[model samples]
Target: MKIIGIVDTTFARFDMGSAAVDEIKQYVSARIIRITVPGIKDLPVASKKLIEEQGCEIVMALGMPGAAEKDKMCAHEASTGIIQAQLMTNTHIIEVFVHEDEGKDEKELAFLMENRAREHARNVVDLLFKPEKLVKQAGTGQRQGFEDVGSLRG
Candidate 1:
C-alpha cells in the first residue's frame, strides 16, 4: 500500500489544499496523511517528519506566496529547505506554489491556484506510478496554461 503525505499552509487559500488532495485521490489508491501548518516556511520540517516518521512514499506541499518581496523571499527559503529534505530522505516532494501576482484579480487568482494544485497533484501521481508520463515532458517547457511547442523551430 502506498502512502502520500500532504503538507499545506494556512496562509494559502483554503481551496488549494483540498483541490490537490481531491485530485490525488482521484488517480491513485493511497492512504493520504495531511498536515496543515501555519505558513509556508513550516513545510520543510513537517515534510521531513512525514517521510521519516509517517512512512510516506511521496509528499505534496501546497502554499500561496503573497505578492510581496518578503513573501517571495520566504517562499524561496522554504523551497530550498524542501529540496534539502527531499535529498535527506531520498524521497520526492512535489512543491506547488501559487504566487498572488500570477493573477489579475482575486477570482482569477483563486482559479489559478485551484488549477495549479490539481495539476501538481496529478504530477505527484505520475511521479509515483507513471513516471513515463513525466519523462516524456522533459525539456518541453509545457506549462499548465501555455501551449506546448516542443522542439519546434520557426
Candidate 2:
C-alpha cells in the first residue's frame, strides 16, 4: 500500500490536515502520516522527513498565512523551502496555503481551509493513481479554494 504524508501548522486556526486526511480517505486506501508543527516554516522539514524517514510517496504541506506583511513574507519563505524539499527528494510536496486575508470572515476562512485542503487531497489522489485525470484538465483554470477563474480560451 502507498503512504501519504500531511504536514500542517498549529498556528492555523482550522485543522486543514484533518480535512485533507478525511478527503483522502474517501478516495484511496493508502496509509496516511500526519505531522503538526508550530508554524509554516517548519512544514518543509517535516515533509522531507515524512518522505525520507517515514516512506511517504507524496506529501501535502498545509499552512495559513496571517493577514500581515510579515506573515506573507514567512509564507513565501516557506514556499521556497517546500520547493527545495520537493527538488531534493524528487517527490511532490503539494503546498496548500490559505491566506487569512482570503476570507472576509472567520466562517469563510474555515470554509476555504476545508475546501482547499480537500481539493488538494483529491489532486494528490489523481497524481498518485490517475495522473491522466489531471492532464485532461490542464489549462482549465482549476482553483482549489475559490471558484475557478475558468479557461482563457473559453
lDDT of each: 0.87, 0.97
- Cα-based RMSD of the predictions, in order? 1.7, 0.6
Model 2 residue 118 CA deviation (Å) reads 0.3
lDDT tens digits, residues 1-154, model 2? 9999999999999999999999999999999999999999999999999999999999999999999999999999999999999999999999999999999999999999999999999999999999999999999999999899989999
* Model 1 C-alpha lDDT per residue in residues 1-154, reported as the tens digit of each score: 9999999998986567788789988998999999999999999999999999999999998898888999999999999999999999999998988888998888888888888888888888998999999998787766652235665532
RMSD of 2: 0.6
Model 2 ranges with Cα > 4 A deviation: none
What TM-score fits each model?
A: 0.92, 0.98
Whole-model lDDT, model 1: 0.87
Residue 31 in model 2: lDDT: 96
- The TM-score of candidate 2 is 0.98
